[model samples]
Target: MKIYHNQLTKTLAQGFIPVWLVFGDEPWQKDNSLSTIKAAAQQQGFSELIRFNTESGFDWQQLMDEYQSMSLFASQRIIEVEFSTTKVGDAGNKALVALAERLSEDIQHKHYANDVIFIFHGDKLDGPSANKKWFKLFSQIGCYLPLYDVELKSMSHWINQQCQTLNLNLAPELTQLLIELFEGNLLALAQELQKLSLLFNQSLITLEQAEQLVIKQAKFNPFQVVDSLLLGDCGKCIAMLDQLQQEGIAPAKIIWALHKEISQLYNMLNQLEQGESINQLYKQYRIWDKRKPLYQHALTHIKLPDVKQAMIRIADIDLLSKTSSEFNVFILLADLCITLYHGDKTQALSLKYG
Candidate 1:
C-alpha cells in the first residue's frame, strides 16, 4: 500500500509491515520515516541488520542470496538496501520482483512473518518507474512511502509540530520568524529547534530570543548571502561569500539559493511588467509584509535582463564547478553578484575580479 510520510507513525501503531520502499528527495522526511520503521522493526524482534548500498557494479544476486540465507546470530533480521538512483537495471528489476514474489508467498502462508523485514530506501521514484512491474509488485505486497518537501504554506504548522516534539514553545510570530529564517530548509530548522531546546530547556522562547539565536546561526547559512545579493549590497555579499567558502560550505548550495531567488525575481518582474498588481503577486507568493521593500528595491534597480543574465552566469558557474577543477566557483559567484548589483557599471569591477 502507498502512504505519505505523515501516515507512517499511525501505520506503525497498527503493526509492522514486512517490506517497505521509502523514497524521496526530502531528506528530513525520508530519514524520519526510516528511523520510525527501523524502530518498529527492532521492537518486533528484527535485531540484526544487513545493509547494502546500490552503488555502481553492485551485484543484484547478492541481495537474493542474503535474503535466502538465514541469520546465524539472530532469528529475525532486517535487510536494508539504499539505492542512490531509482533506475535499477534489468537484473536488479528481476531480482526485486522475485524477492517480492517470495515475500508475498510468505505472507500468504504466514511463514517467516516475523523473521525478516525488507527495506528499500533511495531518492524519489519518477512516475514512469512507479508503474514498473517490480515497483507495482512491491506496492501490492508492502508499504510504499513517497516523501515530499514541506510546502511554504504548511511550513509554520510543521515548525509548530516540531517545536512540540522538542518540547519548545514558540509564539506564532516567533514561529513565522523561524520559518522565514530557515527558508524551507527542514534540516536547518530542525537543528535550530534542537539548539533552542538545549538553551531554553522547556521554557517558552520569545521572539527577541529567537531573533538573537537565529542571527548567530545564520552566519553559516547561504540564505544570508542570497539576501545580501538581492538587497544589492555588493560588499556584504562578497564578505558573506568569503565567509561561506572559509567555513567549507559547498559552492553548489550557494549557487542553488541564488538561482532560486533570481528565478523568482525574474518571474515576479515579468508579472509586474504585464500590469499585475504587486500586492496580489506578493500574496500569491506568500511574501511577508516586511520583505516587500526588499523586492521593491531589487525590482526598481535591477533590470529583468540583468536577472536573466545572472541566472545564465549561475548555470555556467554550476557547470564549471562540477566539470572543471581549475575554475574558481567562488570568484565566478562574486563576479555574478557584482554584475547583478551594478549592472552595466560592472565592466571594470568584473575585470578586476576576473
Candidate 2:
C-alpha cells in the first residue's frame, strides 16, 4: 500500500504490516517514520531487533540467515535493511524477493504465528524504482512512504504546524521572518523550535523577540534574491549570491528561482502589453497583495523584450550549470542580475553574448 508520512500512524493503528519501505531525501521524515514504526513494533512484543546496512559486497545470505535464525529469549523480531541507494544488484534483487516470500508466509498464518517484521529504507527513489520486481513485491505486501521537501509556498503552514507541536505561539511577522531565515533547512527549523519552546515556555514569540534570539540559519534564501532583483537592488542581489555560494547553496537552486520569477514577469508583462487587465492577471496568477506592488514596480521599470532575453540567458545558465563543471555560473548570474537591474537601458545580450 502507498501511504503518506502523515497516514503512517493511522495505518499502524489498524495493524502492523509485514514490511515497510520508507524512502525519501527528507532526513527528518525518514528518521521519524523509522522511529514510529520501531516503537510500534516494540510495543507489540517484537523485542528482538536486527539491522543490516547494505553496501558494496554486502552478504545477502547473512540477512537471510539472521531472519531464519530463532532467538533464545525474544519471540518476535524486526529486521531492518538500510540501503545507500535503490540500485540493488542482481543478488540483492533475488534475496529481497526470497525474503518477501517468507514474510508472505508469516502474513498468511492468521494466528500471528512466528511474526517477523521487515523494514527496507533508503533515500529518495526515482520513478522507475516502482517497476522493480523487489519494489513491486514489497508494495503488494507492505507499505511505501515517499516524502519530499516542504516547498517555499507551504513553509509558513509547516512552521505553524510545528509551533503547535512545540506549544510555541508565534506572532504573525515572526512566522514570516522564520520562513525567510530557515526556508530550506528543516533540521535547523526543528532545532530552533525546540529552543524557543524551552526559552518561551508557551509564551507568544513576537517578531522583536525572534529577531533578537533566532540565529539566522540561512543567510538568505532564493526568494529574498528574487525580491532584491524585483526592486532593482543590484548590489544586494550580488552580495546575496556570494553568501549563498559560500554557504554551499546549490547553483541549480538559485538558477531555478531566477528562472521562475523572470518567467512569471515575462508572462505578466507580455499579457499587460496586449491590453490584458493587471487586476485580472493578478487574480489569474494568484499573486499575493503584498507582492502585487513588487510586480507593479517591476512592470514600470522592465520592458517585455528585456524579460524575454533574461529567460533565454537563465536557460543557458541552467544548461551550463548541469553540463559543465568548470562553468562560472555565479558570474553569469551576476551579469544577469545587472541585466535585470538596468532593464532595457543595458541589454544582457549586448553585455555578455552580443
Candidate 3:
C-alpha cells in the first residue's frame, strides 16, 4: 500500500508491515520520516537494528545471509537498506523482487515471526521505477512512502508549523523573510529556527531581530548570485559563485537560481514581444517593488535569443550535474553567467577556461 507522510503514524498503529520503502530527495522530511519509523519500531520491541548501504559493487549475498540469520542481541531486528540512487543494477532488482516474494510467501504461510522488518530508502522514485515488479510487490505486501518538498506558494504555512515545533513565535515580517530566503532549503531553515530558539529562548522574533540575525549572516547565496547576474555585474556574479563554492553550497541550488532568473526573463520577453504591457507583466510576475529595477535591467540587457539559449544550456548543465559526478558544474555556470550578460558564448568560454 502507498502511504503519505501525514498518515504514517496512524498506519503504524495498526501493525508493522514486513517491508517499508521510504524514499525522497527532501532531506528534512526523509530524516523525520525515518526517525518516526525507527521510534515506532523500537516501541514495538524491534530492538536490534542492522543497517546496510548499497554502494557500488555491494554483495547481495551478504544481505541475504544477514536476513536469514537470527539476531543475537535482541528478540526482534530491523534491517535498513539504503540506496544512494535508484539505479540499482539488475542484481539489486532481482534481489529486491526475491525478498518481496519471500516476504509475501512467509506472511501467507503464517511462517513470518513478525520479529524482523525490512526498510529500504533512497532518492526520489522516477515514473519508470513505479512500474518495476519489485516496487509493485513491495507495495502490495508492505507500504511505500514517497515524500515531496513543500511548494513555494505554501512555504509560509510550513515555516509557521516549523516555528511552532521549535516553540518560537515569529512575527509576520520575519516569516515572510524566511519564506523568501530559505524556501527550497528546509535544513537551513530548521537550523536558523533552532538558532533563534536558543538565542531568544522561544520568545517571539521581530522582523528587525530576524534581519539583524539572518541578513548579516551570509555574504553570498544563490539568490545573490542571480541578483548580480540580473544587474549585469559579471565580475560580482563570478565572485559570488566562487564564494558560494567555497562556502560548500550545492551546485544544484545555484542551477535552480539561474534557471529561475532565465525562465522569468524569457517569459517577460515573450510577453513583451506579444504586445503585452510591461507594467502588467511586472504585476503578473509578482515582481517586488524593490526588485523592479533589477528585472528592468535584465529585460533591457537580455534578449529573447539569448534567453532561449540560456534555458537550453541550463537544462544541459542540470542534466550533466545529475549524471556526471566528476564534471565541475561551476565552470559551465560561470560560462552561462558571461553568456547571459555579454551574449557571447564563444567569448565567455574563451575568456574563462580556454
Candidate 4:
C-alpha cells in the first residue's frame, strides 16, 4: 500500500508488513520513519538485521544471496538496503532490476520458513528518475512511503506538529520566528525542543526559550556565511570562514555552500518585497532553513538590488575557481566578504569570519 508519512502511527498499529520501502529526500523524516518501522519490526521478532550501502562493491547476486538466506538463531530477519545517487549507474540498475523481478516469489512464499522483511531506502530519487520500473514495483507490491524535505512555506506547519508531538504550546508569531531562526535543521530543531521541553515540562515553549536555547547555540552553518557577509557582518562572517578553514573544512566546499546561499538570498529578498505574509511568503518562495536568515539579515541591509549585485560577483568568482587554472578559493571567499560589506554603506559589515 502507498502510504504518506503522516499515516505512520496508523500503519504500525495495524501490524507488520513483509516489505517496506522508505524513500525520500527529507533526512529528518526518513531517519524517524525508518527507526519507527525498524523498531516495530524488531519487537515483532525481526532480528539479525542486515545493512548494505549502495556505494559498497557488493554485486547483484550477492544482494540476492543475502535476501534469500535464513537468519542464524533468530526467528525473523530485517534486510535494509540504502540506495544512493551513485546507485544510478549500470551496476546499481542491475541490482535493483534483479530484486524487483524476483522478490515477489521469495517474500510471498514460505519456502525459507523464517520470515524476512526487506527495506529499500533512497534519498536521491527525484524528477523523472523516480518513475523508473524497479522503484515503481516496490510501491506497487508493498508498503511505499515517501517523505519530502521541509520547505520554508511548510516549515511553520511542520514545526507546529513537531511541537505538538513534544506537548509544547507556542504562539503563532513565536512559531514562525522559531522556524526562521532554526531554518531547515529539523534534527537541531528537535534537539532544541527536547532541551526546552525538559525545562518547561509540557508547558508552552515561548519565543524567549527558543532564542536562548536554539538561536544562541546554532553555529552559523557555513551555508549562511555569504549572506552574513553580504549583510555587512564581516567580522562574524570572516571569523566563521577562518574557523571552518581551521577545522579542515575544504575551501571549495565552503565556496559551493556560499554560492547556494547567495543565489537563494537574492530570490528571498525579491519575494519579501511583493508584500508576502510571512506564511504566504515562505510557501511562494522556496527559501528554507539557512536561507531564511539571508532574507532576514537582508531586511537590515540597504536593498535587494545591492545584494543581487554582490551575489553576481560571488558567482563570477566561483566560476573562475572551477574553470580557470588559478583556484585560490580562499582569496575569492575574502573578496566575497569585502564586496558584501561595502556594497551597502548604510550598515558597517563586520569583517570577522568567525
Candidate 5:
C-alpha cells in the first residue's frame, strides 16, 4: 500500500497497475515518482495519457463515459486525475468517491473490468489512517508512493539516478551543488535540469558544467538564504536578506526561519552538554550538511544560557512583529541579529528553558 520512492519504482518497472496514487508534500519526489509511473505505463502499451481537470467545470458524466468506453486504438489507457487542494472538497472529491465506489461494486460474476488505469495526483497526504475512503481503496488495488525531499549530501546520488533515467552523464559534484542551491523546491530545479539536458551535449556532466548552471539557474531560493543565516555568515546573511527584500520573500517567513534555526542551534548546544560530540550530534539531529560550519562556530562562541536568552528575545520579537500597533519588523530582526552577535553568557545562564 504505502511504499517509498525506490520500492515503488522497482514495482512499477515490472508492470503497470490498475491505479497509481502519487501525492506528497515533497515536490521533487512526487514529480519523479509520477514520471516513473508514466514511463512504466508507456512501456506497458498505455499510449494515451488523458488528463482531466475538475476545476474547469468538468462534466462528471463525460469522465465516467471516457473511463467506461475502452480505447479503440489501444488495449489500455492511463487516465490522470489532477486534484489540487481547492478542487478536492468539491467536484473532484465527489467524482473520485463516485468512481471508487463504482469500481468497488461486484458485477454479475466475480470479474470487474478495469481497462482504464488511473493516476491521482494532489498535495501530500498525511497518512493512510487520516486519508479519505477513496484513497484507502486505491491502495487495495494499486501502489501508493510517498516521496520526501532529497538531502543535500545525497544530491550526487540523485543526479546519478536522474542521469540513468534520462540516459545522460551528469557530473556528481555539479549535481551536489545544484541540490545545495536549489534544495527544498523542485519546480525550479526541474526546469533547470530540462535546460541542462538540452544544452549539454556531453554524455558525462562535469563539475565545471554544473558550476555555470548553478550561477545562471540559481534564483534567490529562500532555503539557501536560511542556510546562510544558520551558518552565521552575517555578510552573506545581510546580502541574502537584501536580495530577498529586493526579490520580495515575505519578511515574516524569513523571521520564522531564523527563529527556528536559532532554536535548533540552542537545542544542539544543550545536547552537547549531555556528552554528545558535535559531529555525531549534528548527524543525529538530521542537521543539513551545509549547516555544520555555522553550528560549529555557534557552539564554540555561544553558551546554553546565551542561546536561551536569544530565543526568548526572538519569541518576544515574533509576538510584537504581529501585535504591536507600531510594529517595526526591521527593529525586531536587527535586535535578534544583535543578540546573535553579542549576547552575554551571564544573563543566558540565568534564563529558564521552555
Candidate 6:
C-alpha cells in the first residue's frame, strides 16, 4: 500500500512489510525514512544486508540469482537495489514482478515470507512509472513512499514537528526565526536540530537563547547575516560577523556576500518603485516566502540611493581587498555593517579597532 512519508514511523512501529519502494528528490526525508526502515528491520533481526546498484548495462539476472539463493549465514536478509533509472526494461520489469509475486504467495502460504526483505530506492517515480505492473505488485505486497519537498508556507510546521521529535521546545518566534534562517534547505535544518538537541538537552529554548546559541553555531550563512542587517538587528549583525570571522571564514566570502545582497536589494528597490508588487518581485528574485517580511523591513529603512552607494562601496572594498597590501577586509565589513544598520551617510564612519 502507498504511505505518506510522515506516516512511515507509525507504520514501522506496528510492523514490517516484506517489500518497500522508496523514491524521492528530497534527500533528507529519503535518508531519514530509509534509516527508519533499516532500524526497524534490524530490531526484527534482519541482519544480513545485500546491496546492489543498477549501473550501465547491469545484469538483471544477478538480482534473480540473489533472490532465489538462500543465505547460509543468517535466516533473514535485506536485499536493497538502487536503481539509476526507474525504467528497468522488459526483463527487469518481469523479474521484479516475479519477485513481488513470490513474496505475495509466501505471505499467503506462510512460508519464506520472513526470509527476505526487498527494498528499492531511486529518483522520484513519475505517474507512468509508478503505475507500471511491477510497481503495482510491489505496492500491493509492501509499502511505496514518495518524499515531497516541503513548501515555504509549511516549513515552520515541519520545523516544529522536528523540534518536538528532538524534544526541543521552541517559542513561536524562535520557530519563525529558524524558518527564516534555513529557508528551503531541509538537510541543513535537520543537522541544526540535531545540534540543538545536544546543546540544550531537551530544555525549552527561548528566542534570546536561540539567537545566542543556536543561530551562532548553526553556521551562520552570509544570507543570515544579511537578514539580521535588513531586520536592523545591529547586535545580531555584529555578532554574526564576529562568529563568521572567528570560524576562519575567508574575508573574500564575506565581501562577496555583502556585494550580492546589496546588488539584489538595489535592483529590487528600483523594481518596487516601478509599481511592482512585492510578491511579483519575490518570485522574480526567487526569494523565499518567509524572507518577504525581512526584505520589506529592509526596504523601509534603506533607500534606493543607500543601496546604490553600498553597492559602489562594496565594489571598492572588493578591489582594495584583492590589490591593496594594507587593506583590512574585516574592518571594511564591520564598517559596511554599521552603514547598513544606520543607513547611508555622506561622511565615512571612523573605523573602531578591537
Greater lDDT among 1 and 2 belongs to 2
Task: Return the lDDT, model 1, position 103.
Answer: 77
What total of clashing residue pairs does each candidate reach? 0, 0, 1, 20, 4, 0
Q: What lDDT does model 6 reach?
A: 0.80
Summarize candidate 5's per-residue lDDT along 1-354 as a digit string, tens digits: 678876876787665477787776776677777887888778777788788765665676656677777687887788887765433555555776677766666322435654577887777676542377767777776777766666656766766666666666676667767776665556677767766777875467788756655643334555665566555665655555555666666777967777887888877888899888998888788767856776777778766766777788777767776776465455456556546756762344322222
Candidate 4, lDDT over the whole model: 0.69
TM-score for each candidate, following the candidate numbering: 0.66, 0.71, 0.66, 0.62, 0.65, 0.59
Instruction: State how far residue 206 of model 1 sits from its true place (Å).
Output: 1.0
lDDT of 3 by residue, 1-354 (tens): 998877888999998788899989888788988988989999999999999999998887666778778878998999999987787889988988887888889899999899888889999999888788989998998899999776666788777877778888889988888876675577778788888999987678899877878742223568878878998998877777776777689999999988988998998999999999889988999888978988889888887887887887888889988888766788788878877856664443432242
Span of ten consecutive residues with least summed lDDT in model 5: 345-354
Top candidate when judged by TM-score against the true structure? 2
Over the stretch 190-247, how does candidate 6's per-residue lDDT look in tens digits? Answer: 9888887888887887888878755533346576677788887867777777767777
Give the per-residue lDDT of model 4 (tens digit) for 86-125: 2366666776767766776555674434377888888755
Query: Which residue window of length 10 is worst by lDDT in model 6?
Result: 345-354
Runs of candidate 2 with Cα error greater than 4 angstroms are 109-114, 219-243, 249-331, 337-354
TM-score between candidate 6 and the true structure: 0.59
